[model samples]
Target: MNSGFHGNTFAVIIAVENYQFRIKTVDYARNDAIAFQQWLINNLKVPQENIKLWLDVDATKSALNEELQYEISNLTESDRFIFYYAGHGFYDGGYNKITTWDTHPNNIQETTVSLNRILMEPLRNSRCNQCLIFIDACASYIDEQLVSRDFIADMNTKEFSDFVRSSNYRAMFLSCSRGEKSYGSPELGHGIWTHFLIKALNGEAPEAVERERFITSTSLQNYLSKIVPDYIKSSTDIRGTQKPWAEVSSSNTFIIFEVSGASSEGSNNYIDFIFIPERLIIDFENDLIIAYLRGLENDGRHFLMYDYEGLKEIDVEAYCIRISKLKNEIRKILEEIMDFLMEYEWEEEVIFERSDDKFNISAFLYEDDKTREITVSLGLSLKISGLHPMGDTIFDSEFDVANDELKIYTDSSDYNVEEVEIQEIFSDCWDEIRRYFLLEKEIEKELLNEIDE
Candidate 1:
């Protein structure tokens, strides 16, 4: 026979607003109840159809008593029940009682329901598999005077002991123990323990919980214990104790969710690669570049060079070993590069070429303007390209540095002007050239950093 059963879950919140209670004070309890209900519905993944909530704001003793009886009578074995009562809790010499809206300190019997009668009589005949009961109410100080003698005498009574033993699979979470008073402050709004309990359920107590881990009953109890006392001391002048209790029989654990990993940068063509210590021999068809540093021997001057055209597969192990030999100096070099890259802003532009795969880059720093311009050209090696200024005359030219020969030239005459200021004319052309190469260098640096890091 298959004995397993799954049923609907239900919650009942009674924030008593009787003729005697203050509306402002009762509002806090109602808010707490609603917040907790919503939290369970959202975070616990409990379906709306599977859960039913009953809220009674200002119910008379007769109405409250009838409602409890109806709820207990309607429960089935496949059902899970949660009952939260936030109001006045009083203990007569024989039994613990919860007050209704009409309840008064003097007229105790007509305004209260015996806690034992509420738990045992109707529930004993119902089909509920599990019941969770929360009571946030005032316990009379008068009960304490008679508790020691009366409770002992009651323990000997057959009916009281039988009821305690028979209420299995049921847990009662109380705001205060027997003979203790549960107080709520206007400043704090709700009772201290109730406040933190709601905070924990809403997933905002301390650190967020991981979605994969089950939230255990012990974790909730532990969190409440830590938060309640601290909140009380900070909010009120009275030093009172607020301890919460939980008796969990089910193995179901609570789970939470969190975000992880690095955020993505918006780039269509970017590819990210993890860094590894390898002998990187970059080949540009006609040239081969070999780079290595030995331990702390080299700092900013850590890189080695070779022509790119002469390279085959590199020995990664040998490259790492060589770099490790100069680790300290190489570390400083890398740090400087990282810092420079962090500070340097670069723009990007796409440059096209007909046949050449390699290019030359030249930078010209103007003394007059204190600004730098870069010129990039394909099939050019060891070249100096700059704007020349000579006593109110300016000329732009590209020179072959090895031969000390000017290859391309432009002067004021090219602008269809005679005796025009050379430096002023060339400065205008320098702006376009600067924009082009700055973009290219930025793209190159980005690619290089991705490779290095």
Candidate 2:
């Protein structure tokens, strides 16, 4: 469990599942809001008094405005603020407004709460160092009496961008892209976007590199962007319809949540060698693409290394330390992948389990009344050089370097699976495993040069 205390954090969570007017009821909005409030309390350790929750009829235009302004006024420069809404939003009379329980569709401008006034303005004017706005509304609404337009026009316009950029510590995360509906799933028992969000807050989100246990605000956005779309395509018939969006202008990346079971042994000083997309550099003059990890030691001394050999030659102890760290990282990645697969409620009985230091992913495919079962078993193989007294193995291969070497082997399963989706999942996991290794783009460039010659 996350033991971190965020007493300074404040939130206003609003969910309107059943409107007083004859508006179409939003499904599972209340559950999503409640889940989020609980997460703030349980995971972030936010005090209950700091959070104000408004459900159904309690979410009125006047109430919302008063609460928002009150919260904003109470916030200090050192504090953090979060505003969340999961309800119906509409664009009417050239204004984007989130509907209150008492909002009549015919009088949208008067009865509804303007998003600019209720959400953006206060967030901009607040002295808080970090503010997050999560709007799960904006799905197209069906009302015969009123002219309903997509909320994207107001959200994606120039004024909206300016509103986001006005403050350096403000970020807004929307559930879907323009003209796309944010969906709720019966299987997941919450809004599809919020369900994945809860999972991410619970620490199932991958792609975080800076810290193992803490999910930074930037990483949360990136994780939602990657996982939501893929899961939608695989699970729902509306494939490629919903994509998460974020307009982040925060200069500092706030640590949002401390994840459970994230820390591994020797993980504190671990250095990654992966060619992350943002940090990757191409060297045309040298005919190579370079990716490296540079970091400061415990004593504040800095070091840079392009490959394992450099570290091995400079400090054997450091090299061995990295070997242990990478080994644990590889296992952690596989465990996360297994956890992800277990979330799918497949019709065919699928067995996902880990035992004896290996992950077994078994699923059945049904085609034309014929059932075929495929199982992918994953494990690691470690080969240590005879430099240390504890291990010695005689092999045909000859070593060029006299220092110790550690070789880790993954992808032991059969790649030629019948299911294409399973194949893709395996391939993705393999790519994640490959991220902990040396420079890949340089190797690819060298191979291409050889092929060209």
Candidate 3:
């Protein structure tokens, strides 16, 4: 369900920037569409051949109909579909029409594609269970006499929900709500709403982490709700005018895109443990490491921790209490360590390698001749599960702190861990790694100078 190659997923993206009629051009419509198409192929891992893209003059009503009909005929319930439109949208003759490149201003209904007939009806009949729809339109300031109403109010109404709810998994994200224009920013090179959307889909959203950095409907909605409005309000022009809206109807959250390096197979090792507060703990007591697990059938029901050989039954309440107390003490110590670490330029967040009980993190040190970037990757191995500690032998030789309280924390999970003791342990490790990397750099420099001589 992550960013693995999903051949079954398909998309039809249309961006009508220049219309045949005398209509104002939708700014950045084409650029937005292109960005989204790239995201589908790169991030979502949808095949390039599976996507149908129509830009400017290429997006005719007939062409759109043909593509929709083709997918409707071929798609199965196992497959997923995505439809995106970025152009002029208006309401006329009791129906909302999405304007195409060949749409006529006067004869809108006959020339343009009807939103219900051409798009919604095809999706309703299509056998695909999951569908993602994104519409960015109604941005241009056109004469009301010719195009009639720009915004479609019913799109936000209950009837719109009923229409899309026919499919089990459906999410429709609109650029703006009723009476609002989907503003395009020259500064952003995209619609203001689309700007944040692309950013969020690229894994900038806060909710994206828990779901393994996958941008789901719920996550996107929450992100857009806060970010879009904040951007509008904070901007110099067009403040408090445009607000994006999303209607998601599904039993489960529908995943849209996974950020870079976010994949099911790539993150399989530390997926369960990463970001889980309980899993972050290093116990100093008897022997307990809380490991959160989720799988095919055992999803969301089991909170398990493994002992030595097999699943040893223990008091769940007492174990949780012990972990909670340890976590609180560790949290305070971590905050102090964070402050100390902030003085140095770190690469990214701390990454825990579960296979070997190794915590790997890196910091940028210096550049050699402005060509080679030097970074010291610290992999601190802790004693866990009766296994000998590996990685960085100098840590044991240089610092005795690891041999005392830190050593106990790694081996057992039943001791009363003190805050001051953990702080000293981490400080010794950090100081040792920094000194080691610096000494190595100096040695390399000396050797290079000797060779030059």
Candidate 4:
């Protein structure tokens, strides 16, 4: 038995496909809810008797009170509850409620179930150890365009940094932040967030460099926090964006499911890597990643990727870590790239050093052997090349040096970027270096903006 689950994990999943009196039906809300129910049964090993699934017409106020709420009330200190609603959510400025099949726009207060009433009050008062709620609908019926994303992870002013050891944990994994919209991926038959979420729950998410298993509140929160939004922004056409929020009361030891057992361990070892698109060649086998994809079919999410675009939503960071390899790992790789560029007769060397600021990395990246070089402070910042007694500030590149990123491994802490991101960041710096060395036409208007693209 998992630490938090001794065959006592119960879920009340509400998936509403059709609305009463023929209201606007959400695109993939029903599908998301149904799939979640199945995933709980198929992947998490939750007993069917422990789950009460209400879909479409079955998801009503009466059903919630008699069935779902009844189940919540009976939960003991050892029990865990998952309350999920994948349908339209009405946020009438202040309060948020789940829009049901019979929910009327005129009388929403009486028609729908207030989210807080169902999950918040009940779980807080109950003896249940962990109560996880997944809401994949929007709060504003007036704001229909921004409806798809409703996963709201909220913490108090200092919720994230504060963790208290508790037998009972209450958290919400919301679809989007308060104002943002959650959009669907046409390639994925279900909602975009739901697609990756199902993958996350299966322990298919990436393990931190330190730990190989993702079974804690912090690990799940960290992985999804990094991955989902990154996937969304990288999409070409999607207009709305979603950033998954979590208000977890730091129960790092709280296990969503067991990973030490043979049944789960077997599948987990094989599904370590996330699905990478065909064109993008980021080597997982050799790169600072031990978690490489064992082919999509063996990984089990192969069913979701019917079209190539489906690869866009796969949360690679959730399941893999990109640690900086043993010393000179980056230098060696850049040297190899330099050797290739030598085929064209232009020499290059990527020299890196810890800068004056402890958090910063300063480097001299040579473009033409030792003759032509640019100083790079941080990964994507270029220090102006110059001969000056007073200062080299005149010709300096003004690109902002954001955060100083390091490739740190983890047994199981929060996930971070790996070799791929670092390479690109420095590569972008190199581009700036080249532009600084080659672009003599500073006389042209808006030279900085020209070099930006």
Task: List per-prediction Cα lDDT, in the order shown.
Answer: 0.43, 0.56, 0.56, 0.50
Candidate 4 vs. true structure, TM-score: 0.53
Model 2, 143-197: lDDT tens digits are 3532221332334323454666677666677887544568888898898889988
Q: Which ten residues in a row have the lowest lDDT in candidate 1?
A: 383-392
Which residue pairs collide, candidate 3?
285-413, 285-414, 285-415, 286-413, 286-414
Residue by residue across 116-235, what tens digits does model 1's lDDT show?
A: 777656767788856666666654234312211111111111233243235545545566432234556566566665776676666665432322222334355445544564565566
What value does the lDDT take at residue 117 in candidate 2?
81
Task: State which candidate, 1 or 2, has the greater TM-score.
Answer: 2
Question: What is the per-residue lDDT of model 4 for residues 1-453, given as tens digits with 9 covering 90 to 100?
Answer: 123456478998888767785456677777788789887888777889988888888987777656666788899877778878777665543446676778775665678776556656566667776777777765422522223443222212122212222333655676764434566677787777787777677666654111354355545655665576667767635434455655554323355654433343334333323343122222445553333222332334421212222233433332222333322333443344445444555333333433221112323333422335322322221111111111111011122112222222111112223444434433433443344334433434467777886
Error of 1 at 51 (Å): 6.7
Better of 3 and 4 by TM-score: 3
True-structure lDDT of candidate 1:
0.43
Candidate 3: residue 137 Cα off by (Å): 1.4
Q: Where does candidate 3 stray beyond 4 Å?
A: 1-7, 139-159, 207-209, 262-453
Sort all candidates by lDDT, best to worst.
Answer: 2, 3, 4, 1
